[model samples]
Target: MKTIGLFAVIMSAAMTVQAKQVAPTSSKISPATIDQAIRLAEATSKEGVTKKITIVTTDNGKSTDVSPRYTVYLGYNSMAEMGNISAAYLIAEDAYSNVTAKRLAPGIYQVQYKAYRDEAGMVNVTKVIDANEAFINDNEIRKACADDFCDGTIKAAVDVQESTTSAN
Candidate 1:
């Protein structure tokens, strides 16, 4: 009985460790938002679109629209920094039209998305704005530790330091 109990405890401990390492996170954007983002990318012209899309927050708060970007770049820096390509991709995709959004004060998410024309995307952006908004609200630390890997920030700092040393 003692041996059986000890074995069970060991197994449980191992399982817990494994679970934390592979913990799953849901996508920040909803299916509706994804659809709208996709449509905005597909649209060829903006025409007479006059609707403002407001994205609902995960915490039931409303997202304030800051400056909209007509051109965007895939946020490779953020992705390399965060090491969570999935989450980065979602934010980038959503950003194609709406660009960046301001959630918490003092933090402006500058993660870029694939560049799409500002004029054509506004209509789809409005359509999705009434729904949920996808934005990068996570801070650098959170993004770096998203998958529990947690070494990206340190690695980035080291790389920067090395570059500086080489330049000097």
Candidate 2:
């Protein structure tokens, strides 16, 4: 009887542990949603308009060229209004422009650029001023927003999803 009782207790404990492990308390945001937001932001900026730029990666002291599959858009302070203005533009990898290259890994990168808007709304563009593979991911972009650029509203939405899943 003693052995049987001990076995039952052990089984119950094991089952509980398994249940907890199977159902994680925290949930992550969907990759698609994050990707859409990034794409939308880029589309709304000047980078979307030009649609040109290139991305390069280096591996083990060897350089490899990668096509710029992603587009970037920049937001700036609007001169006529109190709010900001954003422009969408695009660039292909290897294009000659202000965009500079930053190395993130042997073969990965994140490209950054500074876009400008004139009083007349003429958009002048820069090229990859900075690059890192870390920044290329959507999660990194979501976390990087400490200012008005990425408000709390989006974070709240993500939190809500987590809570809803955990409750179930």
Model 1, 69-120: lDDT tens per residue?
A: 3322112122333232222222222333334332222112222222323433
lDDT of 1 at 161: 6
lDDT of each: 0.26, 0.25
lDDT of 2 by residue, 36-96 (tens): 1221111123322211223322111213543332333211111111122222122222221
Runs of candidate 1 with Cα error greater than 4 angstroms are: 1-87, 92-100, 104-168
Reference-based TM-score of each model: 0.17, 0.16
lDDT minimum window of 10 residues, candidate 1: 158-167
**Model 2 lDDT, full chain set:** 0.25
* Cα RMSD, model 2: 22.0
- Candidate 1: how large is its RMSD? 22.8
